[model samples]
Target: MAEEEVKLHGAWGSPFSKRVEFALKLKGIHYHYIEEEVLTKNKSPELLKYNPVHKKIPVLLHKGRPIAESQVILEYIDETWKGYPILPQEPYERATARFWARFIDEKCWPSVWSSFSEGKKEEAIENLKLLEKELEGKKFFGGEKIGFVDIVANFIAYWVPLIEEATGKQLLGEEFPALCRWKDEYVSSAVIKEHLPSRDKLVAHFRARFPSN
Candidate 1:
C-alpha cells in the first residue's frame, strides 16, 4: 500500500514525532502520518508491532522497515536521504551535533523536568545555560540553519512555555535571556509555527496531569 511506503506512527502532541516530521519535510520527502492515541494505555497494535520494546510514539516505517527512537530515526533519515541534510557534513561538526542532542535527551530534559515537578532549578538552570552558551550568536543550535540539534530541542521552544502557563510554574524567565530569545525566534518561524501542537490542546493536557493546574 502507498501508506506503508513511508509511514510514521506518531502523536500530534509529541515533540519526538515532530522531529521526524521536520527532517522529512526539510528533505522534501513525502510520507504518510499516522496519528496514534499515545496518551491512553491501549496503544495501537501497529505501534506495538513495530516498536514492541518501547511501544512509543515516533515509530518510523520507511520502505516497510521499522526504526524506533527519535534520535536513531533522525540519523537514519539523514543517512538515507539526500539534500536538506539534518546533520553536518564534516565529521567533527556532526559529532558535536550528536553530542548536544544526546545531552538534551539525557541530561537537559531530566534536569528540566525535575525543575518543573520538584521545584529544583539548579541543574535545569545550568543545563539551559549550557545550551544557551552553545547557541550564542547563532540563529539556531545548528548555526544559521535548522539542523539536528534544533529538531531535538523543539520542546524548549514550544512545549515548556505552554506547560509553564498551565501549571503556573515559572521555570523559564528573564534569567535565560538567550534561551528566551531563541524560544521566540524558533516558535516564530513559519515551519515551527505550522507544526507545533496547539497551545490550547497542550495546556489542557498539562492541566489534566497536574490537577491543581
Candidate 2:
C-alpha cells in the first residue's frame, strides 16, 4: 500500500522538473510522473488549478495540495520524507546550503540562461568566471557531498554545454579548471548521470527550436 499519493506535473526537458524528479527519487519516494508539454499547450486543468499564477510544470501534488517551484518542492520532499535526507541536519549548514541554492537561483542560473538565449558571449564568459572563482577548491557547491546547492548549480549543465556547442564557443574556460572539474564531478553523480537528458536528443531539440549562427 502506498503511504502518500504523489504526482508530479513536469515537462521532459525542463531542468527545474529534473531537479524535482531527482530529489524525489533520492528520497526513495514513489511518485507518478506526468510529463506536461507546456510548449505544446498540453497542461492539465489540475496543474492550472494548483499553480494558478505561473501555471508551470514541476508541480508536486502531495495527497491533494500542489506545490510549485522546484526548490520549494525539494524542501518539501526533504521535510516529508525520513530517508536519505538531502538537506543537512545542522541549522547553520542548512542556512549556508539555502544561501548557495538561492545564489544559484538568483545569480548563476539567470546569467547562464541569458547567455544561452541572446548569444552574449562576453557577458556569459564573465559570469562563468565569477562562478568559477566562487567555486574554487570546492568539491560540490555545498562541499564534499552532493546536496541541494549542487543540484541547483548543475541544473543548467545539459543546456549550457549544448549552447556552447551550437555557438562554437566554450564559455567554460581552461582558466577555470576547478569549476570545470566540479561540473564533471557534479554531473557524474550516479543519480544525475543516469537521469540527464540525452545529448543528441537535446542538440536536436535545441537545433529545431533555437537555430544557431
Candidate 3:
C-alpha cells in the first residue's frame, strides 16, 4: 500500500478517540495526531470542517478525505490495510464481531459511563457482567487474537479500572475473574501498553472529573 497523508483529530481522555488511535497503531499506520479541546468545547476548526455534522473527535483524515466516528474509522483502517487483518475472514464470524463491537459502543459503554457518573452501581455491575459473559472462555472477543471487538472494548482494559480507582467503586472484581485477567493481559501486552495512556494520567483525569463519584 502506498502512503498517503493520514491524520487523526482526537482528545486524550476520550475512549472513542483512543479506539481510533489504537486501531491505527495496531495496523502499523502512521498518522499525524491532532489533539482537540473537547472538554472546553473549543474543538478545532479542522475538526469542525471534517466532521461538521457531529463536530466530534476521532475523525480520520486520509489523503485529506475525512471519516467520522471511531467505529467507522476502525473499519476503514482494517479495510484499507491488507495485512494484520482486524476482522475475521468468515462472513458469520465477521458479522458476530461487528455485533459485539456495536454492543460495546451502544450498550455497555453508556451503561458503564452512566453508572459511574450517576452512581448507578447495580446498573454498572449488571452491564459489566454481560461483557464478562461475552469475553468468557475466549482469549479475546475475536478468539485468541486482538481484533475489532477488542479495539472497540479497549476502554475496559484501561478506563474501567481507572474509574473504579477514582470513584472508589468496584465495578469489576473476583466475581468477574476472567474479565479482570483479560484486562491485566491486555494492558500489559507490549503493543497495547505502548499506545495506552499512562495510568496515572488516566486516574488524574477521572479524579478531576468525578472527585466524589
lDDT of 3 by residue, 1-213 (tens): 334599889988888998888777778888888999999999888999999999998899899899999889988998998878898999999999899888888888888888789977676678778878988998877787789988888898889989989889877789998788888877777788887877899898899989776
Which parts of model 1 are misplaced by more than 4 Å?
A: 1-3
**Global Cα lDDT for candidate 1:** 0.87
lDDT of 1 by residue, 1-213 (tens): 255589999998999999998888787778999999888766898899999898898999988899999999999999998988889999999999999999999999898878777778899988998998898888888777889999999899898998898889887788778788888888887777777778899899888877764
Cα-lDDT of candidate 2: 0.79
Which window of ten consecutive residues has the lowest lDDT sum in model 3? Answer: 1-10
lDDT of candidates 1 onward, in order? 0.87, 0.79, 0.86
RMSD of each: 1.6, 2.0, 1.5
lDDT of 3: 0.86
Task: Give the clashing pairs for model 3.
Answer: none
lDDT by residue for model 2 over 78-166, one digit each (tens)? 89988877888899989988987887788777776676677665765676676677678788766787778777776545667776676
Candidate 2 — which pairs collide?
Answer: none
Better of 1 and 3 by lDDT: 1
